[model samples]
Target: MSRHRTIFRRPILLCVDFDETITVHDTTSLLFQLSSSSASTQQQLVTQYVDEVGEFIGSYETKWRQRELISSRSRTFDDAGLHEFLEGYAAVDLRSVQRVVECRALEGIRHQDLVKVASSVQVRSNYAETLALADDWKIISVNWNKKLVESVITQAGVVHEPTQIIANDMKADQQGVTTGEINVKVQSPMDKARWIDNVRSMYAATKPTVVYVGDSATDLLALLAADVGIWIAAANTAASSAKLLHQLVENYGIDLHPLMNCGSVGGRIHNDRPVLYTVTDWAQVQSILKSPF
Candidate 1:
């Protein structure tokens, strides 16, 4: 059982990340691998590009640039050309590694081991507990893969209308070919902040307390914007590398010590505004919410 607080009359706007946050593995990569046999090779190239450029080259601009660059050697931007361009740049072929990760993740969920472990630590089951908590709050998933998040929530027994899921819109042409490659037009950090602002303004009369729960640095902007920021680290791994990198660049100071620090477990308040808490299990999240604010 969980406890509820009455002082907070404002509805909480709960935002979550999709990849590695809710699901154990990135679903998009899984879909790509399952979609085609050459998916592995394509994914490898993309990974290399992202690693070298520090940005996903799934946009029209990137594609155009790649096409132009390869035009001298190849006449068309076919699969091979694309692969070659990608191979010249990405870090790792995430698609190749997704299967093993997804399998392990599904096993954990199917055996109820994750839930059991979470319960042991006093954290409620993520899907169930979150569903229960949604009764009073507006829960939205800010993820790169909106459809995948929708599927997860639906599978969890929660009915979320299409409009409720916020993400970058992907459209394909009539030829059944993706007009533009899969790209995150609105990034997680930007979207989280934008959504929070929108919710705050829309419900200004009620002045609801906004809370954002996430496992990566992509959620940092939203976390900072929210009344509460909850960081979940089930394996004691910090998932804020992107944010840390941005911070380092902005500060122009490179002392790897702070970035490498994993810090302690469990959630706690920070900066007097948004409460910062970390949990190894979701049950701890439930317990925290159950505790008096």
Candidate 2:
């Protein structure tokens, strides 16, 4: 007797987040630190603000409420005021900034092992093959820095088409490069979600199978909107908001973080919704696609 396979007819819309999800380092933060003259000081200030905001957001029962409050205040807080608040209240680590910068600067530095461990990274495990397998696929690497998206596309050896990219800045040009553009400065998480929703609606068709892969809590709203949601685990430290979101998902009987070290895979159904799978290797992902769970 042969078992029947559920074939996915709709185009697999892969909406991937840039930061820690695709790139080994957070390119937006990297660019911010690199662009800043007072890199060390600025990094500390930013980190502090992030921590404080994260803590505050995590304290709330509904994360969306916290996001709304932040968005409202962000409009009032000028760049300088935001910087000051971060420095005073958040207490960021300068080392993290320096490390990110160093990692970004290193040429030919591929986190092959990490890439091998997590199938989420854009370049790893024969991305071209996966792209070819899908009937139709579009990769949206969302981030505040557009340059990072360009850099990743260049490094991945994939054709960079402007219609394929969505980012915040136009400070840098992808001239003579094939890459799509959706210029919108993503100052806050809400901005990110809004852009994602806009993109989804713009490309709306008959029950499009949208998949969103992200590594931070900022991506939670967009992920929730997607037909399939993938949460990529960050190295070392877990972003506070993301951890809280994971806990909330767990409360609903979903195991967001399944793999312990790496090279493990597990998934579970939540509320009779889409199957949430934790993948640690690109090879496993390929295998899954070849013969889906």
Candidate 3:
């Protein structure tokens, strides 16, 4: 039995990331692991994904540092700069998806295969306990397959199943087998942020308190848009583990506060600079949710 309750005056909309934030492992990578491709091809697909993403990060950092040196000042992470940087990632994401399709890595997987994979990927502790605190819960992700995400949530027995799942779709053949072609919808950080805005607009009349929880750069923009943004990380990891995230926040002039320190929405929106809360686990999240907001 879980203590399920909400203390907010207005309606609450909780948006969460589906990857490492909710699941114990990244299910997208697991999709390749479960591919019907030969062992060697599977290894190659995994390696290619890592290499390309690594190269992109390395190149971006090098270019950014060079520009900083030439300018003699750190770049301010304003709206325009942030949007440009995030939107530019759409191409990188598309290339990765295209590679998966061209190689036919996930071509033969079926819904049952996804369900089996979802069983192996565990949700964080107290996830359901915390879900009870929200009026509506939705998952906003850049994951390639929506069914895979739904499988994970259904297995977790969340208090409230997501009213909607905003993600990409996989093209299936006449026989219902994956065709290796993915329709890219939420492809970048910018896309995730826009979806958050779209959700907020739906509840504009009630002015719902929106809380976004996530674990990576893809979740950054959406987290910023929420009334309460929580960054969940490994309990043993140091602050330096999120160097890129810290750099972006510091440069952009956003303030990071401990989740336990946050009380009401008033404190979060008191200034021009946005406030993002950090937590190591869901227990900390439960504490805030248990209180009246």
Candidate 4:
């Protein structure tokens, strides 16, 4: 599982997306459940909305509806319409969502409980191997929450630096309850790509090859930009987080959020980039990393 070998003769920079990519469930679901079992705390997120926040979330839901038009059963996402989708999707206000999550979803949640979820949540198969690969190469996690990602990786015994994680954050109070000042970084595919570009610039002298691993359509931009993009098609599997996500959305009678778009099965979309490799098992990832392709 150790990525001692790579296709590039130069150094390798491995970028992994968090959420369903590595974890069995969306990290938000795990974190959202950490709050107290009070009725208000357990209420639907939309129910907690207010003024501009409500409007922002409503606009975000429009993106969700657009994804609905794509059909949950379809696995292949055509990039032909992807540009238009991203243009409309650019309207999503991530800071608003971050604020909502911090103020509402994490209201009654204690910092200790948040840390505890790092161990309680399920880690995908070959996670140790993934971490091992990171140990031997430049690895960074791009996710929505910085603190949550750091805790999960740290608790898993991976010694990744805080800076290695490009994500958003919400501070906590003295009583171990989460508080204000949301610092968001990786909210969209462009943001994720920007981090990769920054890293690429930093390692310009070494001319490192960037390899990105992600599990959903949200990683499309980063995937397209990478020298090698590996898509983890674990969504429709028996233990797929995407299945649960589909079910959750169904219960609410809504379409999958555009950001949560689980692209088609094991196939390449033939985008501007040569192609993207899709894998259901970690072994496939190991195989790809071991070969020149």
> Which candidate has the highest TM-score of all?
3
| Overall lDDT per candidate, in order of appearance | 0.45, 0.48, 0.75, 0.58
Best candidate (score: lDDT) = 3
Clash counts for the predictions, in order:
15, 11, 0, 2
**Candidate 1 Cα lDDT to native:** 0.45
Deviation (Å) of 269 in candidate 4? 10
**TM-scores for the candidates:** 0.56, 0.57, 0.84, 0.68
- Candidate 3 residue-wise lDDT, 1-293, digit = tens: 89978654767788888887787667776777666767787777678766866676677677667766766444333667666656665566677677778888777778778888888887889877777777777888888898888888778776443457887878888777787788877888878888899999988988888889988778899998887899887664443326656656655556778887655545654356777889988778777665557
Tens digit per residue, CA lDDT, model 1, 1-293: 99986675445555665555566644544334323235455565556545534444334345555545745332221434333433432222334234323322211121122223322222225645764664234444434344445556555666666765666533344544333234344444555677878767877876655656666545655655666666655463443343432332222211121211324322323222223455554555554344333
Better of 1 and 3 by TM-score: 3
Lowest summed-lDDT stretch of 10 residues in model 1?
Answer: 251-260
Q: Could you give the C-alpha RMSD of every candidate to the true structure, in order shown?
A: 14.0, 11.0, 5.1, 8.4
What's model 4's TM-score?
A: 0.68
For model 1 the TM-score comes to 0.56
TM-score, model 3 to reference: 0.84
lDDT of 2 by residue, 1-293 (tens): 99998775555566666665656555544434333235565556567657755565444447445655655222221324223332332223333333434433222212332223233234444545544554344455445345556566555666656766666543323332212222445534455566668767867765455666666655655655566566665444465535654544433323354433333232333334333444443443344344322
Point out the higher-scoring one by lDDT: 1 or 3: 3
